[model samples]
Target: MTREELIKNIKSKQSFLCVGLDSDIKKLPAHLLSEPNSIFAFNKAIIDATAPYAVAYKPNMAFYESLGAQGWTALEETVSYIQNNYPDQFIIADAKRGDIGNTSTLYARSFFEHLGVDAITVAPYMGQDSVSPFLGYDSKWVVLLSLTSNKGSHDFQLTEDKNGKRLFENVIETSQQWASDKEMMYVVGATQGKMFADIRKIAP
Candidate 1:
């Protein structure tokens, strides 16, 4: 979806909540395990239960990848369920993937052409060439990991470079050169709440 469309949807729904679908078999309600397609069933239930309160659903890839082929099947089913049922809701594959140029193209195709998510979270540490491939798609987004939520985010992201710019700031600045504000977004963590205002200044 376009940026305006996403903004419009958020306004219409009066919510900006992105429900994280970190579904785990062990954590699922015990009753669901007995059913066929238990993972999809649980996801369906969760989506149905929470859809009213959220404008988007982010299915973290690790949860599905851990299940091997069955997990992938379940992930596909879950995505299909959303597309078929809740078409207006934005779907994000919270797959923090980034690699060399050729591989990144395949990664983009995997999420955009094949699975067709609205956005994917990606690491920016690999630099521009690795990131630009994902930004080439239409009506999709590349959410670059900037100042993250974890305690270790300071290890690199907060450190100053020779130019006196922090790594996260440099990420936000450099990634902008690759894509417009509409198609690009930095993953400024909620923990770094004050920094978002600063990011907006640079981003705007």
Candidate 2:
């Protein structure tokens, strides 16, 4: 959706909450496992219950990808359900995909064309070309993994360079040139706490 539309939703609902639907079949409700479309059933229930509070939903790709075809089918159904039932809610494919040019283009099409999510989490390790292909689609976005919440994030993201800028800072600074804020966002790890204030000044 366009930035204005997203803003209008947030203003109307007075919420910016994006629920993560990282549902695992093994951990789903005991009864849902027996349903013909167990994953989708559970997801539909989740969206129904949380719909009032959430403005977005993120379905982590690994959970569905692990089940192969069945998982993929469930994922597509989940996206369709959201689009039909709650058209205003933003959907993010938390796939964290990163690859070379041609492959990245295919990946973008798979998510934007096939699965139909509003955006996808992309690993920026492969740089601009990897993320830019996804931006080719109108009103779609690429959420670049910058300062992650994991402990390993400090290993590289916080490392100081010759110019004394931390790696994460550089990622935020350099990435803006690749796409405008309307088509791009940086993932500032939730664990960053106060650090988000800094990242916002750079990106916001």
Candidate 3:
């Protein structure tokens, strides 16, 4: 989805909520276990209930990927269901995938062409070549990992260099050369607090 489309959805719904569909089969309610595809069934129920209040849905890929082919099938069904039923809602495959250029190209094709998600979280640790391939698709987004909320984020994201610029700051500045805000976004953790003001100085 384009930035304009996403913004419009938020306005129409009067919300900026992005529901995370981290549907772990093992954590599913016992009642749903009898369903032919429990994962998809669980996701459908959540999506239907939350669609009215949310503008976006983010399905963490690891949960489904761990289940093998069955999980993948459920994921496909979930995406299809949302596309057909809630077309206005932005769908994000929260797969923090990034690799060499050739591999990234395939990853891009799989998410953008095959699974047909609007955006995918990408690990920018591999640098621009690893991320550029995903930017080729119009209206598709590359949500780069920036300042994460994890405890380990301090290990790298906040580290400063000889020039005194923090790693996350450098990431935000350098990545802009690859794509504009229209097609790219950064994942800034809510816990970052005042650091968000710092990010906006560079990103905004």
Candidate 4:
């Protein structure tokens, strides 16, 4: 979806809610275990239940991928289901991928082309080339990992630069040069609270 379409969704729905389909097979309801394509079945239920309030669906790649080939097929089917049924809702693959040039390109193609998510969460630790491949797709987005909600986020993201700018701030500033706000978004955790104020200073 384009930036305008996403904005339109937010306005019409009056919500910016994003549903995360972190469906772990082990935690699924007992009855669902007996179903064929259990992963997709669980995701479809969640989507149907939450679609009214959510503007986007983000499927955590690791959870689905851990189950192997069948898991991957389920992920594809889940994405296609949303695409066909909710064309205006944005889809994000929470892959958090970052590697060298070639590896990144393949990842970009896998998520943005074949699997067909409108966006992918990416790790920027590998720098420009690692993240740029995702930016080349039209109307696609790169949700760069910045200040996370994890306990250890204070370790690196908080490091102060010579000019006293936080590492994540520098990341936000420099990366903004790579793409417009519509194509790029930083992952700012709600637990960060006031820190989001700081993020807006750079990202706004």
Clashes (backbone N, CA, C under 3 Å), per candidate, total 0, 0, 0, 0
Q: After superposition, how far is residue 34 of candidate 2 from its true place, in Å?
A: 0.9
Candidate 3, residues 1-204, lDDT tens digits: the string is 999999998989899899999998889999999999999999999999999999999999999999999999999999999999999999999999989778999999999999999999999998989899999798999999989999999999999999999999999999999999999999998888879889999998
Query: Model 2, range 51-78, lDDT digits (tens) per residue?
Result: 9888999999999999999999999999
Which lDDT tens digits does candidate 4 get at residues 114-201? 9889999999988998899899789899999999988899999999989898998888888998999889988987888889878888
**CA lDDT, candidate 4, residue 201:** 80
lDDT of 1 at 58: 93
The pairs that clash in candidate 2 are none
User: Against the correct fold, how does model 3 do in TM-score?
Assistant: 0.98
Candidate 1 has a TM-score of: 0.97
Model 1 lDDT tens row, 21-81: 9999889998999988788999999899988878899999999999999999999999999
Question: lDDT: which is higher, 1 or 2?
Answer: 2
Quantify all predictions' global Cα lDDT against the true fold.
0.90, 0.91, 0.94, 0.91
Q: List TM-scores for all candidates, in order.
A: 0.97, 0.97, 0.98, 0.98
- Residue 169: error of model 1 in Å? 0.4
Of the candidates shown, which would achieve the greatest lDDT relative to the real structure? Answer: 3
Regions more than 4 Å wrong, model 3: none
